[model samples]
Structures are given as C-alpha cells and as structure tokens.
Target chain A: MIRSGGLRLDGVTVLLADGSKFTRKLVAQMLAEFGVGTILEAEDGETALDALKRGPVDLLICDTLVENPDGITLTRMIRHDNGATYRSIPVLLLAGHTRQADVIRMRDCGASLILAKPVAPKALYDRLAWIARDPRPFVDSAIYAGPDRRHNVGEPPNGVARRQMDRERFADQTKSSVSHDEIMAILRQADSL
Target chain B: MRKSRFAALATRDGGRKRSDAVQAAESQLATMEGDYIAEADRLIAQLNVLSGAAQPDVEAIYRVAATLRGLGGAFGYVLVSDIAGSLCDLAERLGAAGQVDPPALLAHAQSLSLLHHRRVKGTGGDGEAQLCEGLARLVARWPAATLP
Candidate 1:
C-alpha cells in the first residue's frame, strides 16, 4: 500500500485493479483528492490476489475487463476466499457499457456496488459513502457469497414491491443532491455495521 | 478521532475545492481525447478489414471500444463515449449472435471518426446531431443495451 498524509480513506487501504496505466494513475489521483491514501495498484487479477495475501484492504475499485481472472471472476474468487477480510471488504465495479447479462452476473457474483464508466467523483463518493455507512450483511449460499442484494432496509414489509420503491428513490435522488444529514447518517452508521 | 477526522475531511470537501477538483479532472480528460480517438480508429480499421465470411475479432474490438468509451467519457467527451459505447454494445451483441456484418461494422467505425473530427472542430450541433441520428438508425438495426 502507498501510504501518505492523514486523510479520510487514508486509514482505509484500497486496491485498484485496472489494466490501463493511465486509468489507474488517474483513478489514484481522484482517490487521493478524496482523502484516500495507501492505494495498492494492480494491473490484473493475479496481482490483486497477490496483494491480498500481504494484508487487508478496505475497498476494491476494479474494472470489468481486467485481465487474468477478469473483474467478475476476481470478485467471485475474493467472495469465495476463506480469508475473512477478503470476503468482506467492499467492491465497486466499473464498466463502460453494462449489459443485462453482465448485471445479472455481477449480482450473482455478489459485488457490493456497480458504477458506469466516466464515473463523476461525486457519484463515486456517494456510493463509497453508502458502502461505509451501511455495510450490508453478506449472503452465502450454494453460489452467492458477497454483500446481501436485499437493500430495502427501511421498507416496511407491506405488500408494496421493493423494486418500485427503489426505482422511485433512484429517480428522486438523481434530480437533487443527497442532503448533508443523509451523507453523515451514512457515515455514522458505518460503525454499527 | 480518526472517524471524526474522516468525516470532517468529507464535509470540508463540499466547497470550491470540490468543484475545482472536478474541473481539474475534466481538464485532464480533455488532454487525452486525441489518444482515445486514435485508438478507436485503429480498432475500427481492424473491425472493417474483416470479411463477412470470417469471424470478426469480437474480444479485441470490444476491448478497444470499451477503452475508448471509458476514457472518452472520463476526459469529458460524452459524444465519443456514447458513440463508442454504442459500438461496444453492438460488438457484444454481434459476438453473441455469432455473426459479423462488415458493412454495419464499418458504418459505426466511420461514425466515431467523423464524430471525433467534428468534436475537435467544435461543430457539435446539428451536423453532429445528424451523425448520431445515423448511428441511432444503425443501432436500431442491431441489438443495443439501453436503446431508446
């Protein structure tokens, strides 16, 4: 891990799995600006796995097309790995243009969050905030072994479908900025998880 | 104390520095615009040379277009990104169908070239609109992920 000054996500070590050197440097710069230090870079899945062997990582920001195991398979490996820290650390998967099949596969593999390419820093921050605030319970089955896909924690167990609520919230949030309290509440809740 | 410091950093960032950071990122992305288009051209040429009888290198084309799409958008070239995205998506779909149409591939490839040229000229108005319309027509013919 490349350590630096005291900052948010400074204590939180990160592993970035991307094949492009330019992209990896640019992403590292962005994360640095976000107060993240100690970012470990990996050009492929093999490198990432090797890094995991050394110590724990707080988050994994990876590209979908990373070589070797590929991003999906890499995430699956981490999910299935017997190491506790590897299985539980948050993963944010990035893609250029995601297909339905890709989404289904990512969901099945148990990725924490999925973001599209050309990710705005604020959008990336929001997702990271979500991960830190509410580290969702993991669901291990005959297959899946990542964060629980069920995200409707506040939803009353009424007859209303959770998908509809999610869609409505997504539409609403897209229009305006998430409130300060909303972000902080998420931050404060990080410990409870 | 570590947690509070983290929170303070996060909160303090919601100011001019944040927008400045975003602007700086955009500026950096602008510098790499040429490289993205250049790579797209090379990839499209590879796709164009393929005979309809022989299989197009789907994985290779996908990698190029996907990189173009990501990098183009990262550097604030939405047109390049969107156009490359369409090509990438079509590549994936065609690869899935186990058939490659050279003519269709050429049109999409040329469109990226044309779009990049126009974008450099700062003529991203009606002319670009029409180019995208042409692209949309081709996209309509092919399978797209989020085709409207």
Candidate 2:
C-alpha cells in the first residue's frame, strides 16, 4: 500500500515515453489521482531525450518499445551523461511482456524499477512511493581511508572499492527472467531501418 | 454486414417480445467471437507486409497477439486462443531473427486470414463453436508449422 501521508510530490514532473495514446492517457489519469502536478508526454525516446535536455525531471516512466532509440538505450544515455540533472532520477520501465529477462536488462541499464504492461493503478502508486522515499544514502566514505594503507591492501582503495560496490548493488537490483535469446528475437522483429 | 444479418435473424418468427429480442441479441453476441478472431487474423496479415521493413516494430505485433490470446480464451473462443498463441510464438521467433522472410511470412499470414474468414462465415454450424474447434486443430499442428 502507498503511504500517501507525506507524499506531496507537487511540482514534480513525470515524463512518459510511450507510443500508445491510450497508455499515455491512462498513466496521466493515474498520476493525476496521486496528485502529480505536471505530466509530460513523449511518443518516443528521441523526443523524451530532447525534453530532458531542456530541464530536469523528477521521474521518468518509459515504455520498452519507444518509437526512437528505445527505452533501454535512452536510459543508458541518460545515466551516462553527467550534464543531465535528471541522470540519477528514478526511471520506471514498462514492458509489454512480463519477461524476467526484460526486467533484468532494464535494471542493468539504470532503470530504477520495471513494471509489466497493463499496469494496475495501485501497482503504479506503490512503485512511485518506493521511488519517492528511496532511503539509500550517497557518500564518499573512501575519503576517510588513507591511500598508503589502502595500497598495502590487495584490493583498490576504499573509494574505488565503494564505487565497485555501488555498481554491484545496482546490478543486484535488476529483476528479469526472460532469456537473452528471447529479447534479441523481439528486438530483431521490432527493428526498422 | 454481420450485425445486420444477426439483427434480421432476430426479427424472424412471431417471438417479438422484448425479452426474446434481448435473448436473441445475447446469442448473437456469443456467436460473434469468430468475427473478432477473424478480424485479428486480418491484422496479422497486414503485419506480415509491414514486418519486412528494416525495423518492423514487432513488439506491437506481440502485444496484439497477447491480447487476442487472453480475450479469445475469456470469450470461449478456444480456437482463437490457439491461433493467437501460435501467432505469439511466431512473433517471438521473428523478433529473434531481427528480420523477416517475406515469402514464408506471407504464407503464414494468408493462412491466418483464411482461417478467420472461414470461421466467421461459420461455413458449418455455430461459427463461434467451429472457430473454437479450428483454433484447437491449429494449436495441435503448430509444433510442426513452427519447426525450422
């Protein structure tokens, strides 16, 4: 259940990258129910990227099959670029098929969460809550470790080690069951030009 | 055309009571499952043509087939379900290939379209029931058709 008590995400912007008009309308309606102030819509990943360049966003909910670039590609680009203020922002990927492999791929690409399509309003709300109250702290604890002592150690220094640890943490967050072959096949069928 | 035909059949005989009309309409609704499946089949045919493009957007096809499988089963069109399942498998395969075989794809599309038309015309008895049976037969034979 979503704890709506302190859930005032007013003025937060949610960008949606979906080709389906019906899905966009449905998500907009669901977000409105949760008191989201402004909602932005994009038919594909290219448009969403352009929108991101213009400013920062609080959340991004994208379909796996956006018209251009595709959701995973868009997510990777966003995470890779440092100029984008929303680079670290939470991303929720919606997949038409609830394949575990797809979920894992999305997570690997830096998506905060993945939801199977035909998403229920309640499920969306719950995911939003989890994103909103992310408790993980970001810090440079390695700065506290001296280089000489770290050098004597077989592994890298604390900062480098912590960075690796963070990568592993995000890697573990991926939740996909679909085989790589299945995803590749779907991509092949969907690719144009 | 189909709706009109059902409406005309409903008006036949002196059973002109409102309740009788409602019952007739319900029966017609039950029988239209074949029509829906046929419509899906027609769409699949169109998809075959479109899929030959460089980037075919096959995910859309998979999504449509998934819907058909669910709805067909819900409406008691078991044959439709089977056909939809096969279509789903084909879509998955196409996705893996990342390309389309125009000739083979066209043949499969034609088969789906013809199956839909035959079921919808209810060439035999109770189009919906026959469609259900046809879908079952298609499913039984899918393993063979799907094999490389």
Candidate 3:
C-alpha cells in the first residue's frame, strides 16, 4: 500500500534466494543502496522457506534455478502451502534465459514479476517501485493462484493490439458512431455544398 | 480473488527518493566491478583446470559457467556473459547425453580465459566475435537435449 505521494524503500526487509553467493552479494548491495532495512540471504529454497517461517519479509527475490525446490516451486509453495502470513508477500523471480516452457511455468508459479538476469539498477528500482504501487489483487482459484496476470488496467487505446481477439474487439469497440442529428446535419451540409 | 494490499502496506512507511536510490545502487555497482572481475578471473581459472582434467567434469564446468553468466553482464562484461551462457548450454546438452565433447568444452573454457585476460568488456571486437561465432557453430552442431 504505497501512499499517494510515494513509498520509500527504507525499512523494507527483503529475502533474496539464489544458489550463487556472488549473486546474493550483488543483489544485497543493490537492496542496501535502496535503503532497505534488512536483507536476508538464502542459498537454496529450503533456506528461503526457513527464513520465511522465521519472520515476515517485505519481498522475496529468487533466482529461477535456486536449489532444493527451485524458485518456481518455491513461489508455488508460498502461494499455496506456506503459512497464511507468508503467502501474499510479493515474489520476484530472476532468470538467465526464459524458454517458452519456462515462461508458462513461471507464470503459473505465482511470482509477482520475473526479471531477467543481469538486471540493471534502474530496472530493479523500477520493479520495486511498481511492486510498491501495484494494484493487482491476489487470486486464489482452483488451478491458479498469485497476483492477477493482467498487468494493464484495460486494453491499450489506439496501441498495437496484443492478440488477434483483442484487435477485433478493439476495432469493434472503437468503431466510430454518429447520432441521427449529426448524420442529418452532415447530409444537409453536403446538399448545401 | 482479492487484492492483497500487502505490498503497499509494507512499503507505506519510509524510504529515500527513487532517483537517489538508483544512483546509489549504480555507484555501488561501479565500486564492486573490480571485485566481480577478480572473482570472474578466479572462476575462469577453475574452469580451465576442470576442463583440462582426464574426465573433464562437464557438470563442474556448467556450475562455474553458470556463475559467470549470472554476474558477467551486470559488471559490463557481456562477452563473458554470452560465452558463459553458451558454455552452460553446451555442458547441459553433453551431460544429458551422458557424453563429453572435450574439444567443444575446452574451446569455451579457453575463450572465457582469453576474454578475461584481455579484459574484454561489453561484447569484444572482431576477433572475439569470430571466437563467439565458432563456439555458436560448435554448440549448434550438438543437438540440445529434448525438454520434458
């Protein structure tokens, strides 16, 4: 719940999960610079889970290939299996390369966002800011659970439609309409011209 | 079905300006570049030894290459990251088949070492391009394991 003005990152506690110590150090450094209050490091899913159980964290940033359960599995656990207190916190997954299959799995795993590896500082900061202000609601359905996958509030107006159906729908929805009076006035003007 | 409102609540309290935070983070990354390079060099050395072994542990090579790929780009070493990524894919393919392509694996190790030694940052020059092209061809020659 970022306030209307903006939310400061200070006092935010982040749980970082990655198998590589160097990666952990890099991310921790970034979080530190953002004025994050506490940064918990976990080398594997087990450790990450343990950390979650130990205390509440403001965010979870995990690498896709984290050991034991892996990041996708970990996120699923948090969304479905973990204690109520830990289930809803934002989960950001990091990946080196996202194959199509991986994308489907990642989406289904309930992550808040999946940032590509070697994430720039600006990208990370922007993602954090977005998370702070994100209006997406949590969805707990039979087959899927996580933040609502829909990112945009509504269809992009006059922009490239994302899908074939969207293009048709947009065309139909945005088709111009004229009132009977306007039509009559245009006809009268045409006759006068 | 319900908006958590948790993230907003969690973040409502305090923090610095966004620009200041990003600037601070970038500044810190610049300071840490030297350390990353050192670590990258050490990993490349380890890859050299592992790739040169009698058995040539492809799994060990993959681990080292994965680490390199993970951090190389962040420190402005895109060439290192690309070569490391290729190396990881190669290692995975070979490991899946229960086989070893010593020449292909060794080539990647050598390329990484060469890039690190030359301090090639951000996708190196023509020669490095040729090296990368050769590695890509080599990787393409070997079929990747079918994803399940």
**Candidate 1 residue runs with Cα over 4 Å from true position:** A1-7, A153-193, B1-55, B120-123, B143-148
As a whole number from 0 to 100, the lDDT of residue B1 in candidate 1 is 9
Model 1, span A125-192: residue lDDT tens: 55565555443566777778877777564422221242233223223212212233432332233223
Span of 10 residues, lowest total lDDT, candidate 3 chain B = B1-10
User: What does candidate 2's lDDT look like per residue over A1-193, in tens digits?
Assistant: 1132334445667888887665576567666555566789999899999888885566789988676888887887787775456666667887654333354456457666676543444445546655554433321132221011122213212333432332343233122232345333333332321
* Interface RMSD, in order shown: 16.2, 23.5, 20.4
Candidate number with the higher lDDT (2 or 3): 3
Ranking by lDDT: 3, 1, 2
lDDT of 2 by residue, B1-148 (tens): 0111112222234322333333433344455445545556556666556545555565666666554443333233334444555556656655655644433333334434544444422122343333334334333332322222
The global C-alpha lDDT for each of the candidates, from Candidate 1 onward, is: 0.61, 0.51, 0.74
What TM-score should be assigned to candidate 2?
0.50
| DockQ of each two-chain model | 0.10, 0.03, 0.13
Instruction: For residue B14, give model 3's deviation from the true position in Å.
Output: 6.4
What is the docking quality class of candidate 3? Answer: incorrect
Q: In candidate 3, what are the lDDT values of residues B1-148, reduced to their tens digit?
A: 3444435454565556667877888899989988998889889999888877878898788877877887877777777888898988888887777887776777788778766776666554555565677678777766776645
* DockQ for candidate 2, C-alpha atoms: 0.03
Off by over 4 Å in 2: A1-6, A98-104, A137-193, B1-60, B63-89, B97-148
